[model samples]
Target: MWNHFDTNGTPRTNNNLEGYNLKLNIHLSIASADIFKLISKLKIEEVDASLKYFRSAKNEKPPTRNKLYVINDAILLNQKQG
Candidate 1:
């Protein structure tokens, strides 16, 4: 489940989710928010994810990957094929 070599287009790691969690923590700005506030923030996240999904389904490209990651992916692809 952790491997990505045979799974094209799948995330190679949970970096995206980690980044999202970091962003959420920053937005919350509190170590312990009330239940209602937490729910509100989660709803916002859900809406954002849904919008991104729809945009992707419509062929709108998501943000470009970092150049370093792009290069690494290319290298891995070459190694996998060879």
Candidate 2:
């Protein structure tokens, strides 16, 4: 039911979310972390997200995507246009 045809320059997959989940899992380092530990990690993520938001708000350019992704995006754009 999801359509990304008109959503140019946006991700077409959940890879980013999956990557974040993997990172969080590694940081937790346990199958079942204590509630307090989970809360602390969540707070850290919140602060990191806030910092990125503020930086973007100040007109700072975000980090570039990987070269592979850049190429893939170009190809997809060409396909969409043609």
Candidate 3:
């Protein structure tokens, strides 16, 4: 009724569809992870832009209060709200 091979040389259908499903799932999971990372990056950029806009709107001066707090990378921009 059936033909099968075992490790010793029997034949079988045990090399079946289950493994195919697992391979598909692994690929799909990796793609979804990439999408999630892209969304997070977009959100962070949006927040940063919003902060910069409102800070600029007020046209305030940078703190002459502490010279040490300055970061070299900081835009030295952004005014405070009235």
Best by TM-score: 2
Q: Write the per-residue lDDT of candidate 3 for residues 1-82, one digit (tens) a residue.
A: 1121112223223443677556545555664567766577667668976887787788866336334334411222222111
lDDT per residue as tens, model 1, 1-82: 2266686877788998999889988988899888898899999889998999999999998898899888978877887888
TM-score per candidate, in order?
A: 0.79, 0.85, 0.34
| Clash list (residue pairs), candidate 2 | none
Clashing pairs in 1: none
What are the clash counts of all predictions, listed in order? 0, 0, 8
Clashing pairs in 3: 4-10, 4-11, 4-12, 5-10, 5-11, 5-12, 6-10, 55-79
Question: Distance from true position, residue 82, model 3, in Å?
Answer: 39
lDDT of each: 0.85, 0.86, 0.48
Error of 3 at 16 (Å): 54
Give the per-residue Cα lDDT of candidate 1 at 80: 82
- The lDDT ranking, best first, is 2, 1, 3
Per-residue CA lDDT of model 2 for 1-82, tens digit only, reads 1265576777788999999999999988999888898999999999999999999999999998899988877777777788
User: RMSD to native for every prediction?
Assistant: 2.7, 2.7, 27.7
Worst 10 residues of 2 by lDDT: 1-10
Q: Which candidate leads the pack in lDDT?
A: 2
